[model samples]
Target: MDRRQFLELSGAAGGTLLLGSSAAAEATPAVATTNHPKPVGAVTYYTEIRVPPPEKAAVLAKMDELIALMQGKAGYLSLSFKQTIGESTMGRAYPNPKKAILAEALATLDGTLSSPKVPYFYVMFLRFDNYDNLLASGVQAWFKANIVPSLFAYNAATTPPTKTSIALDFHEGVYTTVAAADRVNGYMTAEEISTYLASKQSDEVAGQYVSVNNHYMIMDVNREAHYNLLRENLNGNTRSIFRPIPGDAGYDDSDPDYVANGQPAAADNTFFRKAVTREILQNAFPEGEKRNYLMHGVWETIMDHENSHLDPRFSAGASQVGSYFIAHPVEPFYITLKQDRFIKSA
Candidate 1:
């Protein structure tokens, strides 16, 4: 199915509406690409859901039921349900609230540190073997049938439930795993990753030990060149500053530059993936066509990620690409609460 058809099946909207605003919702979508490379990587449905405290249990129960239905589907790979643990404290060292509005939002809805007055946010990743399977997963159908009512139905007597979806927002997009790597594994293909998963026991396969960190930034559609350049250069900078030498347990602590460059004292084992082809609800600050880019990384511990921000090289790279950011970059850590994988034996 084409992009429009896919959207029709899934109620994925391009702009977020204020809680009760009736103003026309406008989305400045990135111009479609012409003669782009054929998509040839694992695709995922990345969804974000905001749930009120009272509805959390109900939402999770529905999620469990949904997982059961997905297990037997064709080309189904894995499903991960993640809970937001905290935001990046290290990021605070840099200038923030690039926009005044963001500062106000954070001040009122600061869910990262203490009690949150706003709804809790959760992230779900539904992976498939390829783009076709992702488009045909039928998850949207299941959600429409089973999950939609729970969000909107409060009073049984009312014809349309007399209430709106309890969840504050649902933001989602189709994303492709464009790049992935680890120091020991080096780089893995989709088949190789399947083999790797097959070798792991259930606990490791579920990713019980590591923390998943999501780094989000906004990129102007017209500045594709700048985005490409940042990706290329940032990859090199992160690898040099963070990744340990292959086969080595950790970085040489004796090197004076190690601590200075923000390398943690402990062994650094991090897996990184460059996920592309996803967009988030747009805002006015971008001032042009824009897309959201997620830099996903798995770290041994949250501190391993937090300490990396001390590196001056990272700051320099950020300044170089600062203009592309329409909003302040947000990095948050998540814990896997529920996960399941279907791996063919190697």
Candidate 2:
């Protein structure tokens, strides 16, 4: 089924809504192409929710309701309560607002709310219209100042998660509608791209245990022809995916330079597609226990997300989802992951 058709399937039943179905309530969207630029004025939140197995479904339901409620409130934009993927610990960061909002809302409910003793992790993302609006608008500011700050106190807080990183992106002043995203170094040959990533020991790129192991190849394509054609086949809310940062241990500690100052250099699709595709193929996966599936699934999911982002209209905000979070300097080996609830352009 197409994207819209997939939305209907996400619903629980006739006249009933599930978590994924709730996010699909936004207006119908068009297709995307390689020519799309980073969205303008987008502020995204990256966090995780903690819940019990039995209550996981209910908490997720409540999260959908809270998201719908927050949308009604001022300054709130889009949000996603991402389901756990591959490994549970690696899915999303801890202390997510979906979990918190569920708890708070359930606290005021009747019988056995937040009961049955099941535990799950959830992250509530509250995207704003723009970076300025994130801090300026009271509705957005309230969540940051009042709601999101004290999240660390949660019982299931994933402290020092196996991985964590927050990503942010903004359109460069010199960027164009057709300018390609450039990140690989000056390597005319495939060997050079491999050498660049291999010798790369930057704390930002290569850190303890996990490393910047994936390459996302993005391009500019014809809008009406290729973009629209692809839109006809995207199933479910898969368009919600976007290029993720270098880390995924449930912490947003990735260096901000990747997205803040780093982007793929714009070039012909043939060159980028071939070069990035090669770089990704050549990179060595981390020798972790779940390396094989994680590497494959992570890259696949991320590529899917970036490709979906080709449709520029639906993703119309800046810093949508292709940069690393820059909360603090990398200390020694481990970087602290923080929530990027909204953008604050300087």
In terms of TM-score, the best-performing candidate is: 1
Which 10-residue window of candidate 2 scores lowest in summed lDDT? 169-178
Q: List runs of model 2 lying over 4 Å from the truth.
A: 1-41, 88-118, 135-346
- The candidate that wins on lDDT is 1
> TM-scores of the models, in the given order?
0.61, 0.26
| lDDT (10s digit) by residue, model 2, range 38-78 | 33333333333333343444454555555555545444544
| TM-score, cand. 1 vs. native | 0.61
The count of residue-pair clashes in candidate 2 stands at 45
Candidate 1 residue-wise lDDT, 204-286, digit = tens: 22444334433334545544566455555445544455533334455555765543342442323332122111111221123
